[model samples]
Target: TLLEGVEEKIEDITNKLYVVLAALIKGNRANCSNFAQSARLNWLVNRLQSQQASSGALEVLHSVLVDSPEVLNMITEAHILAIIGLLDRNGRDPKVLDVLCSLCVNNGVAVRANQNLICENILQRRDLLLQTALVDHVTW
Candidate 1:
């Protein structure tokens, strides 16, 4: 099957998944959350941790996490770890920051991961990124 083949391929799986998930999420939110808890999603999160995530994948991930906060409850620790790492890597990316900030403000997995992300990633590098003169002077 095409879905099974996508699982086997490594080259463009993340990008392919971005399209698949975007469509799935819109078709049925509950099923999408179930899919998010699957091993395939675990693989996707692992890719994000390795910095292999595409912009589309990250955008869909943010949308899923923010739009369906209940999904956070179903996500595994591995997912949390990957999300934390992804957030750290893209702290300066506003899309990532926006989703992460919303997650931190909400309950469940995000609430638990919030302290760690802030203390270890965002806060640790505050002056270098968030509070820098460049951020204040430049737009975007």
Candidate 2:
């Protein structure tokens, strides 16, 4: 029932909802633009702050970056920090890095808009970046 769902923690719900939202918006330009313009953009960015939900949030973030051109200009410094955490924070959470890889591999407008900032942060934290790669590459 609706009440039962309400009893579930919002973070738990959003973990799945983010992926569903990402699937819904992937390759859909209008929805992507709407997501960027709406308060949902803030939600997506803030979702990255949640250790429980950041991975699903990353999925939605990757989908939006791949799908929305308008999102590039809309990004903020805080957003950059959140995305940076994907590479070197939260202990290089594999799920987070996997979606971060999508951003790198896709290199859409949002990633390009943020690359200089991202690069600067990466360089400033060289040891962290190397550790992330080592962890990501380790087979066992």
Candidate 3:
């Protein structure tokens, strides 16, 4: 349903959604804690399934983590990883017309291969991506 749109404007609208989400949580301690403890964060985690929404998800997640330190201290079973890296495009990403999260790096290779695997849509990998994709410190 997310991809269903005028096509050209899908990205614009998606970016705007992130702007709204970011504005709602930025520097708000209570909002951040509720987001961390509530099921609302699942929506953002699910958004990561879409390559289109993944960048904004990360940016918004960064804001959440930065605004609330309690989130980290409460990571008993899981944790969040604010990964920093550069996405060196081997070629022009024609499919990706625009990106909300900028990967400003000089290197050509980026690690966190687990993320690539979980997000891949191969015959077997597709099941894993659909069933359970890691969003904790290791993958993100």
Candidate 4:
């Protein structure tokens, strides 16, 4: 069984397993330091940085980012802020944006603070303002 195989490979599964275990135990209140110190996080970021060369890698990362609670918790507030800032400046993929918004909501983080700023930025782009207003009002 997969559980038995995983048990056999326990030592080789990587620190992400421990980080995930901690998050599962503590939920949204999980300590951020474990994520910050994780080698697995570094590996994930490196993999994302190189994703342009391989679309399959991007899909894998999108899956991890969207589906893994541990991976979601591993995202620091600084990283979230940066991504929101980038979305404000350059727009964003709707699917990815939805995933991010959902993650923020699920993690019990206040998405309103930066989400408002991003909406305002989008509004500055002419006809998009109305759409932004509608989304903001609904989400709020």
Q: Give the number of the best model, judged by lDDT.
A: 2
- List the pairs of residues colliding in candidate 3: none
In model 1, how many backbone clashes occur?
0
In order of TM-score, best first, we have 2, 1, 3, 4
Question: Across residues 74-125, which tens digit of lDDT does each residue of candidate 1 receive?
Answer: 5565565555565556656665565456557554343756556455755555
Per-residue lDDT over 1-140 for candidate 2, one digit per residue giving the tens place of the 0 to 100 score: 98867756776776888778878988898888887774777777776876544667787787786677567567677777787776655666666655455544444324564567767777898776575533446454
Clash count list over all predictions: 0, 0, 0, 0
lDDT of 2 at 66: 66
Overall lDDT per candidate, in order of appearance: 0.60, 0.69, 0.45, 0.46
**Distance from true position, residue 68, model 1, in Å?**
3.3
Off by over 4 Å in 3: 1-5, 73-140
Report lDDT (Cα) of residue 74, candidate 3: 37
Model 3, 58-105: lDDT tens per residue? 566656656665553333211222121112221222212112111111
- lDDT (Cα, tens digit) per residue for candidate 4, span 15-87: 4453454445343334333443447656544543433222232233344444444666566554444444434
Model 3, residue 61: what's the lDDT? Answer: 62
Model 2 misplaced stretches (Cα beyond 4 Å) = 1-10, 93-113, 132-140
TM-score versus the correct structure, for each prediction: 0.57, 0.68, 0.45, 0.37
Worst 10 contiguous positions by lDDT, candidate 1: 127-136
Q: What lDDT does candidate 2 reach at residue 131?
A: 50
Per-residue error for 44 in candidate 1, Å, reads 2.6
